[model samples]
Target: MNIILAIILLVILPYVGFWKLFEKAGRPGWEGIVPLYNAYVMIKLCGRPTWWFILVLIPGLNILVFIGILVDFVKSYGKFSLLDHILAVALPFIYLPKWGFDKNTKYIGASATAPFREKYKIALKKTATREWADAIIFAVIAATLIRTLFIEAYVIPSASMESSLLIGDYLFVSKVNYGARLPMTPVAFPFAHHTMPLIGTKAYWDGVELPYYRLPGLSDIKKGDVVVFNYPMDADSPLYRPVDKRENYIKRCQGTPGDTLSVVDAQVFINGKAAPTPPHGEMSYTVQSDGSEINPQLINDLHLEDLAPGINNTFTVNTTLASVNALKGYSNIKSIVPTLSPKGMEDPLYPVYPVKFPNYKITPNFPKFTWNLDNYGPIIVPKKGWTVKLDSLTFPVYGRAIEIYEGNKVQVQGTDILINGKKADSYTFKMNYYFMMGDNRHNSEDSRFWGFVPEDHIVGKALFIWMSMDDNASFLNKIRWSRLFNIIH
Candidate 1:
């Protein structure tokens, strides 16, 4: 259906407009019907370099080239109004056919005015308000196009990625890294994400939703990459959000498709081997210091935060490896060890499939598998086309993926598993899934609290920190000079 529409818009409509416009410009009307050659002829008519046709092959760059061609083409017809240029680029089918078929519209050629702006000087100089409105409108359109299809600015709002990314850090997320997702909900308030600020109302309307689609990207996601994705569970809220409009979250990709992920004593393991941790990844530690208190300057120098005094000269701190190692050098500090949950401790953890879907339960043979934030999974991340045998015990692990994420009605009747009302023992995944965790292990409520991140929920890759400010610091000291323009690893 979409393919047919594209053909009509890009080929049929353009062919019709170009055919009439070509006759007005004294070019052979049939040349406008030729696919690639039509663009070449149009470029030639506009007095642009013929080599620009090469740029039209590139995705994002092609939009700019087409806009330039259309603007010049309209100018060739002596239509120099800002509205004319907008219509030439936005609705060339309507603008071109009207100008070409209408007897009054004449081809003034390129030398009518030295500058395009000079041709509309009288009308443009008439009102400052009109000029300001045109500038703002053009600026919004250009910025919106660039932001939706290329790169967008984002700011860290939570300490989830602390130590690697801090609160108040401004980042540029690259859409081309994992491919830019076409907006599922296209109509929305300008520059607002999820909700409109202050008003706390939805920024977008659910009407006219499009299917999930992505353009070609530079590369696929790799392990240890800091990725931004929409919160998958946000749809569970009372006021549902479209896939792309869910809360944006940034975390490190710990497990890719098909990899089994687990955490033992707060240490992540993938496929039975220990996964590589980020250099600045951190965890909460219980530090036992001597009766004498540690100097506030030393604590400040180590960049430690959330320092809480524990009983008997013990202190709990969330810090990076370098800071932990530096603290260990002090003879007064007895030990610094990870704050691990006791083994066999089964408190509520992620997915909570059994609770969410009461029909499913752990098989007696599995010894009621207990998991915690510190000691989690061994669960396999679902891969596209991978089939898994479903049973009582395995259901809790993959139930959400099969039912909610994959959009299937799943249930357990007696000992048999029913998917979409069919008695099936196995199911194949439709899309690849990822497991994301923050660098601040204990502090982050990440995949361990939720399940896998579906492919459609992916947003972009965090490229770099353009600015960093400390919220707690004075105005003069707020800017973090060293972190400015720092590349996000």
Candidate 2:
């Protein structure tokens, strides 16, 4: 409904403003009020090929297409100045109608036609200022189109995806893999994502958000694929932003829609089976030594993330199995075991800034379930058309998803669940959801910490690492040349 209103008010009104202008161009005035037909007539007036109209159908590309057509349509009336084109796009409801009413604004000829170019083309050389301005505008538009509709470059800023995707690794996330999601927050500053750099203000307007929509994609997100998605937590609260404008996070898809998933001592089981683990994945381990401090150099060699010395000469470390095996070989090492949280123990860091979760916690929010970080639910991931009984247990697990991400008004009173103001015992999911976990399990702030990632929040599949830089390495050794173009697992 908002999209239709936006089209009627912002889009169709411009064509309505161009009614007289279209009639002057030898087309019927009624054609201007007709949406797609108006664009067709405008293309004819501007002498652009009929195929150029396809741009109007593409979601991300249409913004550029609309502006370009406006510029071309205005130029057909001998309005060639940059200001004229700018107003034609920026204030089309005002300037388009102004031109439509101005008798002096003549339908000179098709804007870019050979005959029109021969007659009205100025012999004066374009000023250096104009050339630079034109170049910058063209570059911005071209880059925006490419970034939106095709592959985009992403840099790993944290060790959440360490090993499989290291910090400082520049990856090419393929939009086409799981389809390019249309911009929900369309009125955003170009290149600036959710926030304006330096100023620390929002870069997008949420007043006119479009619905969650996606173009056709090569494949669906499946298990083991390293995927990039909008951080689902940003859907509400003090950090709320449009889904597309949410912070980008990359993780390995461990559980897909419809699959029941559980974590037992940090090992994920999907649908009653042990899921395939990433070769580079790491997890927390408690390393006990025979009251001896191991060599500091050996600690660095293991590439352990956390190496906090515990009481009784034990060390709580986070590292891959390879590191654990290497540590096992040491003479002073007594034992190394996974630091699993015993069943029902709440994570000490829960419901806080460092550990960002929903408004409520486990027991009070939902039914009493003794689930913790290392040992969690055998919860079913929601799939489209899947219906669940909306009670205390299910509501807490899926309430945020039901009311917030899926766009519904969910209210709980006594023992009754009300969705969209209607008392309902069950709710059908509108979209599929996935479980994402970082390869660096203990260190990663991922789906395990938050919840399931909605299908709409999915961005793209990580294709490969184009560049990798090691910040800790010396200048000469900084370039991780061997990892370049390595296909993401």
Candidate 3:
């Protein structure tokens, strides 16, 4: 008797729940949970050609079929108007029941078709309609809140900010360190964010100025700070905005508003003051994976090279002139703040100033890029009203200005001001972004080329390392026990 009851519940409940779905599809109620038969009825109600579901398994054409399913499903049931149809497609679960249970008296059919399915077939359903509805809403809400208010997860794919952050290191970025942005683009169906992509053109159709609003969070930004922000170039990827709550980056903030920054001999000097290097723990003379000895300076496998005019060429130093030139270019060592140099300012035109070299190279087994990191800078971060003539330009050194608006839309143009196809004398800024780099130096590709990360793009500061694993390591070395619970300062 128990087995029979279990079978009955399993077979009977879905039909009861999906009876409304059958009616919405213009089919008889009993056809609701009849797998193959209901599929046949759905094809009939939507007026689809036979075997369309089979074609839906095809890669590219599946998208087109899904679209057709949405369109036909809505039109066959007159419960939803045109706008409702659009909203339902973006987020279907919201209108599923309406299509199911609504008593709207219209169901269109061609050539006198009957409403009921002929037979029942068993099939596995992925998720319940109710669960789907809740999941969609939950994901969107959680993504938004985590993007703005709490912590966000990000994976590092490249070695740009290496040493400090490895390629496989996944991070939880905190948004509370700064602040979050309120959701402005509101037309998304509870779960469907598809329409957001096609919404490239702003909805300025209403003719009212949509004033930008910012939800205040952290009070200040500090230099040498490691931060995560949105990628300014690709705002439309997942989050619709360049600086998003969705995508994040981990970098050290080298410049802030109103602060002059310059790098001299690879040393970063902010606002005419020298930036302090993080304290290096004791050095270990262990051999690395590549058979290179891992010494104190090799804690992160840092390579230091001298790019000085007369220094790198010394025979006793055992350095290559080409490597030195590469160091000069990579480190921007010709100028005190090489990264901040304006574009077209490549030649060493500035008067050479004497800089004292640290004795890091004296240590045997020290990497070649050490001297590059030893250099300091003296430059300033741009403020709202500050103006300066840019003679030369440098990539990754300068941060561009951007204006973020209500619709997850953004406009980016910088101080090398261009206006209406002409260059302007001075430019104004809506918000400021900073350039960040990793201590790994040579391995990290950062603001040095892509551009400044705006305040709105900032995701959060990294607080700690909770879990870590290196797939290449042995079982004993798999877990990064020393890094576990380590505070990210």
Candidate 4:
């Protein structure tokens, strides 16, 4: 049976059973299925204002609403006190039905709450063990609903976004924040968010089954919001790392759609104006023997084989900062090949190091390459209805279309794609890519590395930080009082 249908059966069966029991007590039987109307019937049975339901919507105070109802239920049955309160709350199904159907007690027009202390007291009551046993299951359902549809817990991992979000920061991620994605994978394991038996399976790709369609969340991605998303390479894989077990990273949005973005002298310029940066953060650069290059520090170790001694040069690198910094005092700037330390060397199996250089001069105040993080494109992002054709003439304008080879045989082409020899029409297009970067310029592996991050890979914008901690030096570091309550720009 479908799990939702099973849950409906489990819930409605008892309410119907209680309705029949209410009929035996000379009350309206239809009250059982009317939701809040049933609450009104119980209120009338216990003698209280029906307007009290309004109090149930207040945060934190709603616990008192249920507790007050349970107290009233016990009192209606001529039962009161702490132990009765426990049964009314901890095992409410037994007490609610007992008060409704117990023939031994005659209906007295008893007030549930009297102004004095005596009126609020709960009386002792006894009911069947069956209701007591079902308490755990019912409570589980209530808790599960709140977690699945309202809010959930997530832990933050990595320092991609330091200062704002830290490693080991626990967060209450709202599932409803982006209205719920239909639960396509129904049998998820408890607390893990992984589907059991069919673990690692995805709903659909490109446009297959596409089992889930989520309603839009709070708002679209805003600049500077920390967001968590599925890695573009593989959506089926969990975002969290096992060691931290939160989504893999928390990064600030540096660019949004339709923005003409460029980085000049380590200061990001959006549409020909300098972007405001945080008061305190580092501006990273690529340094040569002569001077420094101002740019977004490329944190990925890139070793393309075109510019080294070996016929096949491969870069096993830690990061790649472009030499795009203009010499502030000098008109002409130049870069010599950098000498690597012992630790910077790579082995034959994993041939890293000695980055290949193109025959291009390092010029001051000029955009170096077409798509470095700091010197990226004038290419406008394609929105819906924008058509694209992949031919040699138009391919370069979109992006480079190069064929990668394995053992002198072409395996893949530009934009991480391949052309099948047998079928010339087998070329496939991937999703549209967007540029993403970190606020902390020196440290971030973003669109600059493996190319642009697809727009579909965007999760949601990071909202406000409810809490903050200083975990840089030690666990006991003092809180950053200045940063507290500060809005993420």
Candidate 5:
């Protein structure tokens, strides 16, 4: 409704202002009411060639051309002040009506001899401060629009996707791949994610929240695509954040909507078939070595992260496939084996069943389901309009989705489930959900730790690494030259 009102004001106010302006310029006042023809009249008023009309139809380029036209339009009225030009571009509806209807303002004929730079200089000479302010305001508006709708730069802060995406790697995420989500929390500090940078307070207000909506994009999110999204469980904290304002997380999409996902012996399977893994995916392994301590040079050469020393000189290391293969060729290494969680053994898992409220105690029946990180279920990812029976066994899996993510008051009564105080035998999911896991499989705190990520939380697709840096390296060696500008898989 707010968006509709905004659009109406934008259209009606400009139309009325332009209609009056048309009369002052000796053109028919009704011409402004006619949609595309008004633009043609506007182009003629700016003294530009008719071919320039086609340039205004383009997206990004049109903004510059339109701004130029508006500047010239204001100058054509003999108002050459920097403030007037800024107001014309930034608040066109308000300024246009003022300039058009006010008896004092007059239309000075377009100066064909004066160059654009000379006219801009005449307008800006006395109002340097206003000119600078206008430039900053326009730059911020343009950057925010591009960031929200097209592509955004992101920095990797954790080692969860190590080997593939290193700490301090700067990425350009493409919103066009998975579609750009409209701002749910519209009022936020520009460039700040969840919290204020220096003060560390909440960066956005929930006063004017909007429903989740996305603009159509180039493609749908497919399996194996690296994705960035808001952390679903971040809202469990005392300071609640809206969907778009929650902490951002980057991970590989392991399961798509409607897919049944499971992990057996640390291997993922989607719909009864072994899922394809990323070429650079990694996991932890226990490596037994001779009594002597391993050489630090060898560790550096293989780019291995030594987790900790195990019993009898065995070291648990987080390493990539190439590092593991290189370590296997050493004679002194006794054995190397993957650290896999045993089946039929229950461990702390996500979406802890029957825990209705946030930060509540785990129900006693949670142990009935024997699922671990490595040996998870053939559980289904929720799809829009897909129905699933609500039972004790399935309640734990979908409870968070139904109650928290989808916004309902869900309760499990004796052999019955109630949503919003009414009995519900099944639930047709309102939004699709995705399963996300990091490329560094064993070390990641991802979907396995929390739960499924709803479509509303998705941000964009990882596009490329514009810059990469290693903090642990010396100053001269910090920048990773090879990874710079590399396309993200």
Candidate 6:
């Protein structure tokens, strides 16, 4: 389910009531069923040059061209009400047929012609209602374009990037920072993402998908950029979606394309060099107290995940290093140490992805990996044109990416690998890939669990926090006033 030439959807809509419309216009009704010819006939019926329909293929001009043709066609049939024009695009199947089949609705002439417009100028005069409607429509379109091509507002929905990006933090993401990805699912409802509100149906139609394309960016996605991207796994939802319509996920890019990334004892390393950890990044730690019940207020004040009771006044909690150091000064706190899963140790609470295989025999036929959340790969991020040999070891690491993300049919049979029905020893990546991980290391479901995020899944770079709210706080203290307009690191 990808692109369909784009024009077929907004312009031709041939399978709709175009046949009846064409017949009423003194043109062969069958012409309405043809592809490009139908669109040409539409422009011709609107008294527009047939060649003007070519603008329908042009990205920026397409919407204008469609609107013009729609307005002209409707006006030709004496349908001039604002509601009529709105439904002409919003519910074209119903409106087009209603207009086409109605005996009273007759084509006056080419309503877009200069002579017709001059004659109807007084009739087209805007009422106060029409003036407001036009202004609001223009505003909606302008805002939509700005949000699509420049920046968009996003709210942090989870504590995955807590301490850095808190839940309820509203931020502006800059599409220009890493290039604005053109909509792959183009025919979606305004302001609605994948799902319609209340009714819970799909908000988009897959009939008008566009191929992945990006405008030139100010810079490439670099390490440490907080990025909002389409969830590569399609995320928590069971229902699948087109790439751009997939759930938006926010995470720090731990590794960019072509970088070899690894997590050693909870610290990230890129190309054998230790990368700087987020200033307020949190991880699970074992905290032993001096046989005193630690203050519950301290836990809430520090924003620790929770203090799970254990023997000997010890507890496991997730909090930032700064908070851990603050607790060290308290007499009741015995020791605070980060909880790490030793090289061969796997934590039930922090299960790593199967790509980091653990139990397989290390033979030519099988591979073994004991990687865990706290200790992960030296896996290479796939760059465009980068090819890697596929085998037992690499299959688990990159197979899903090669097959699903890159679109291929893969099969394995007794030591032989088949891609697209042919034997393939290697695969060259069609797009660059990224490795994303959240600030809350142990508690985050991230690239460590899934795998690489394809370039097409990128949305934008989070620019700054515009507003922040504390949902658990009292009404008077709800606003996180200090964080407003703070630039995202």
* Shift in Å, residue 355, candidate 6: 8.5
lDDT of 3 at 312: 33
Of the two candidates 1 and 6, the one with more favorable lDDT, higher being better, is 6
Per-residue lDDT of model 1, residues 79-136, tens digit only:
7677888777666656677777888887666522446446655643537776787778
RMSD of 1: 4.9
**Each model's TM-score, in the order given?**
0.80, 0.90, 0.48, 0.44, 0.80, 0.80
Candidate 1 ranges beyond 4 A from true positions: 1-52, 68-131, 348-369, 411-416
Model 1: lDDT to the true structure: 0.80
The window of 10 residues in a row where model 4 has the poorest summed lDDT is 401-410
What's the CA RMSD for each of the models?
4.9, 3.0, 17.7, 13.0, 4.8, 5.6
- Better-scoring candidate (lDDT), 5 or 6: 6
Off by over 4 Å in 4: 1-153, 168-184, 194-210, 236-248, 258-275, 278-281, 285-370, 392-434, 451-458, 467-487
lDDT of 4 by residue, 347-383 (tens): 2121221211110222332223333433444444332
- Runs in model 3 deviating more than 4 A are 1-136, 183-213, 233-247, 280-378, 387-418, 421-423
Residue 19 lDDT (model 5) = 86
| lDDT tens readout by residue for model 5, 93-150 | 7888887899988766663225644665654355668768768877876787789888
Which 10-residue window in model 6 sums to the lowest lDDT?
Answer: 353-362
Task: Report every candidate's CA lDDT.
Answer: 0.80, 0.82, 0.47, 0.44, 0.80, 0.82
Q: How many clashing residue pairs, candidate 5?
A: 0
**Cα error of candidate 3 at position 49, Å:** 51
lDDT of 6: 0.82
Better by lDDT, candidate 3 or 2: 2
Candidate 5 TM-score to native:
0.80
> What TM-score would you give candidate 2 relative to the actual structure?
0.90
